[model samples]
Target: MLKLLYNKKASAALANLSVGGRLPHAILFEGPQGCGKKLAADIAAQYALCEGEQKPCGVCSQCVKVERHTHPDLRYFTVPAGKKEFPIDLVRQLRQEAYIAPNEGCCKVYVIDQAHAMNASAQNALLKIIEEPPAHARFILLCENRSMMLPTILSRVTAIELELPTVEQCAQALASLRPQNSPEERQAAASGAGGNIGRALSLLETGKPARAMADAKKLCELLIFADRYQPLEILAGYDKDREGLLAMLPLLKGMFAQIAVSHYAKTGRDERVCNRVTPAQALDAAQAVEAAVRQAGQNVNIPLLCALMVERAKQALH
Candidate 1:
């Protein structure tokens, strides 16, 4: 099952909560993109709406409906296509609908995808309902980074973080899911995506590395060379593409992490990033990239954010 394999910690926690009947009114599944936040949310929804005693028996009618996304009591929401932020109008509509009782089950589950993309206004609008949610209502928020969320919203939600699997694990999964592909192909895709299963599968399907990963790799090269002009030039390409910028952040973070690890481990390090910076500089740059990633979800101006990220990264290196 998607819940059991990739993230044991998250799986155990969600299972315990559902079995103990101690699920909170709101839950936030925070993780990098393609790290199974949506899958975890689906599992949580099943646990809440499942009619079986074991909670999400997977064979029960409610569980099947939830799996098929046919459960009336389970509602899914995301930023509308082509829209940059979660609009306030949608939040207002959802708030009005939240007052209604569940249609088929004892409780209602609302799965909000990209919760981090919610602007300050949308978050405030959502807080009103979450703060005093109806007895039968439940919320499961999916976010890439929790720092973009309002403190009040974060305070009310139970947060669950999911970790990426190893390249070997991801490759094994791909073998089962994409058996037509050779083992060599699977491993290559897995390594390219840094163990993100969703991204690896996408790589397999397209036979092309994602643009975000390419851009991130380029940025890593520029940072390693301590080039000033090229970093700004690359970042300017993302000024109008926040989603692309968001996708790139985790890749950048992962590369920096490798750089930091390489400094201490002295072997099995990425060739492109090895010996580029001092150990302290690599660690500091990793933190800098991480902070930039967290800040990306804050609805900040993309150009300004790119500038700040470049500045901090350079400062950490030099």
Candidate 2:
């Protein structure tokens, strides 16, 4: 029921439970950013709250209200902008609200985003309610790292971990989400994001991320084949664009990762994960990029660093 492009396992598991009318009262959706955990939580909440026979039939008023976030029965808790952690004060308030009767829907859905931001006391306050939640209440916790939660709290919920999609899968997802983008554009965004479709979407939706990714991809191709000066010329545009320069580093590292994966694939080891680049020198290139990222953080001279990075990459690739 989640409209996300990937993470089929989590989707299927949740769907099965909803259809069987056996969905858990408390759930945890955990993964790195852009892995679609939040969206999964939304869909699960809708499915659980829907009153229709088919359950979460999007046409039903209950489902529509949940989608629009106008449902009185569905509430959320997240850390405020300036707060360093999810405070116990708010958790206590949530606990008190949890027992109240739903105003409209068959059940009440409670969504907690960035659940990892809850400190020890805050999670403890939350554990009390989830340990013995009201029969009409469902809790969904969205977390960046599952380990951040207290063991006791984690045990009380059904946890689902989301995985990153492959580049081709990401490209297809992006194609569906952004029909205006060319396949090549979607593929570039997918590659630049390290196969995170959410990140790819952000790259396409925001011109800055897309521009930085374009520069990184161009520099990657030039590093592999261009003359030394040509590559240096490419780096010059990033002279004052610190954000762009930083964004390019991960992508440059990813290109080396692709080469390493491609090498294993050629040996028939990891055929499921494919990459276009083949290199006898992937390790060297990867190390050079790592060093550049490290040095960039230490206030090095910009122009000197840029030229040196190009030279190091050129030598490593050659």
* C-alpha TM-score for every candidate: 0.64, 0.72
Cα displacement (angstroms), candidate 2, residue 89, comes to 1.6
Query: Clashing residue pairs in candidate 1, if any?
Result: none
Give the range where candidate 2 is weakest over 10 consecutive residues by summed lDDT.
269-278
User: How does each model score on lDDT?
Assistant: 0.82, 0.78
Please, what are the lDDT tens digits per residue for candidate 1 over residues 158-252?
99999888867988888888899766566656765767888888877864335666787789889879577898898898788665565577677
Q: Going through the candidates in order, what is the number of backbone clashes in each?
A: 0, 0
* Global local distance difference test of model 1: 0.82
